[model samples]
Target: MSNIPPAGMSAAEWQTRQELAACYRLAWHFRFTDLIYTHITARVPGEDGHFLINPYGLSWDEITASSLVKIDVDGNKVADSDYSVNPAGFTIHSAIHRTSHDAAWIMHTHTRAGVAVSSLEAGLLPLNQIALQFHGRIAYHDYEGIALDLGERERIVASLGDKPVLVLRNHGLLTTGATAASMFNTMFYMERACEIQVATLSMGQPLRKVPADVADHVATQYQSSMGEEDDVLLEWAAHLRLLEKIAPDYRD
Candidate 1:
């Protein structure tokens, strides 16, 4: 068993715990979770260069705030936890965190839609509103088996190249943001984009792609719209409320 402090034991830590746990349940609610495969991490509040991640082997539906494991930039589990962190998962997340300091939260998942889109030769197309928003930002990292090798970190980081979202070719999806909610929201939209692409492709007809110039304009517009702090907080709170209604156990 892990010696996890009770939720609300520390105001900031508890808040991080709530947000991280809510992210897990919300991932589950959105059908983004797969057993213990995905991970959602939050930078420790007021703790420099440290963060918390799901204890390896725990399903998203069963994760609670306190049950999460604490780790440093090197992926070392400094906290008192019976479980170990997944090396492959840590390799991907730690690399991104080290590169993107503003990314306080990171989400990675392997949904069917995500993998399906990743296997496509065209990658993400500018065929719809959701797809066009990712026109110039999405990155792709060719899969090298499981992400267990630390050497892959350099390549993964190189491939992401300042982008907020990455599609692990032959694998799944990833998104980084300033908050767990924001990261999850990004993944939600990215996966939905992939799902939409797959559904559209299955129609056996040509896709109605938007013009490159228009896609660029819309992408810039979304980037601006996401800049407001109030908007981010409001969306975060709304997601938390939804999680509370759907999976109250995440707060336990």
Candidate 2:
């Protein structure tokens, strides 16, 4: 809400804007966006504390590089924009931002596959290597309906403690990262993992799962060998290029 920059915003702030905006467009292209419901936020470039988020009510595909609003950790609109932000969106994002120092980029979604998996009593069954990667890292936050109450922040924060990803029970998914790319990549993997797990479970056959030690080894290798650059934005760039060929209006 305040106009004060978290630190001082720099010329690079504009670049962060473009990338974050591109992320939104890419989300729509992936069909990861849920109308105007989900939110993706990025910290302002060269600024220590401020971030940019979409104004509520705008379809994710409608977001443009220049249309994002600046806001502090408190969730007030700091910049001039025609669009408004949802308090619930701010509530979820702000809690993570405040508690997690590594959360430079945060994303949340309610994809059908994600919500379906969340509702299942089993919750993200380890039916494959992907699910196993999150064997101990993923946290679960029971849904409290629309996430408007400030009281929910405590539980949300506690559930997400030290974990990079969270599956909000009967609600959706949340991911935190050191960059927008990493967070997006995490969400994509989590959603896919859930989708496959659900589909596999529906088959009603004996399910094959990875050994916990092997899963941990693979996850450690992924972290050490691949590193952060191997995230969604690399492929996401290709996705945006494809969107340009088809739904060019998303750039508007």
Candidate 3:
């Protein structure tokens, strides 16, 4: 058993498509979607400069293994299909994928909690234990209109700077990982962290902040717990089981 499994395994393209489709279905199940607007993308297994994205205009729940669009880093479709991708949605993803191969999977969302946290001047405060897990690990990128410009990719990449999570300030949340399981786990926790932050702030009272050194220590503990065979995949497998029962058609 390998300590660190391959990122996006160089397995069959069908398997990659299946997991990518599962990512969409799980996002929909978890309400991480913005209609057909936001995107979740993955690097095509064994291929360079090509990726998979949900087709334009299909709600996240409607995404399927065969419906995902294969596109270049530039977001242009590379094969014949009934679907096409939203260029603007790919704008953020392409920047990271083009620059960081370690980020084989990326997720972006506009959930109310996520946006509320991002809109805060002090973003994603360490309000609790879960929130503390991200103390020194996340980055922020200022929202630049609607991510339609190619040149903004550079700045977005700079903001990311090898981090796995990026709060698109004044916009929403983003998470990256070498695998869909890892990325989705990050997205799930990141969203929950924002939800906790929002719930705490709504009280509108004096808040007790975690001492900075204690926060850093807890974050270090989290980082140490994750890399050994990635127990997050166990949670991801449980998610896949739930999806199988409720939305088996996603594997179509």
Could you tell me every candidate's TM-score relative to the true structure?
A: 0.91, 0.87, 0.94
Instruction: List CA RMSD, all candidates.
Output: 3.2, 4.4, 4.2
Lowest lDDT 10-mer window, candidate 3? 1-10
Q: Order the candidates by lDDT, highest first.
A: 3, 1, 2
Clash number for each model: 0, 1, 0
Query: Tens-digit lDDT track for model 2 on 60-155?
Result: 878876688888877777777788888888888878876777888888888889989989877887678777667677888987898888788878
The runs of at least 3 residues in candidate 1 whose Cα sits more than 4 Å from the true structure, single-residue gaps closed, are 1-10
- Measured by TM-score, the strongest candidate is 3
lDDT, candidate 2, residue 28?
83
In the predicted model 1, the residue pairs found to clash are: none
**Ranked by TM-score, top first:** 3, 1, 2
Taking the tens digit of each residue's C-alpha lDDT, what string does model 1 give over 112-138?
999898888778989998887688989
List, residue by residue over 1-252, the lDDT tens digit for candidate 3: 112223543445678888899999999988888998998999887789899999999999998887888899987788777887787878999998888999999999999999999998889898799888788889999878988999999999999997889999999999999888889989999999999888888899999999999998889888887544458878888998998899888877
Best by lDDT: 3
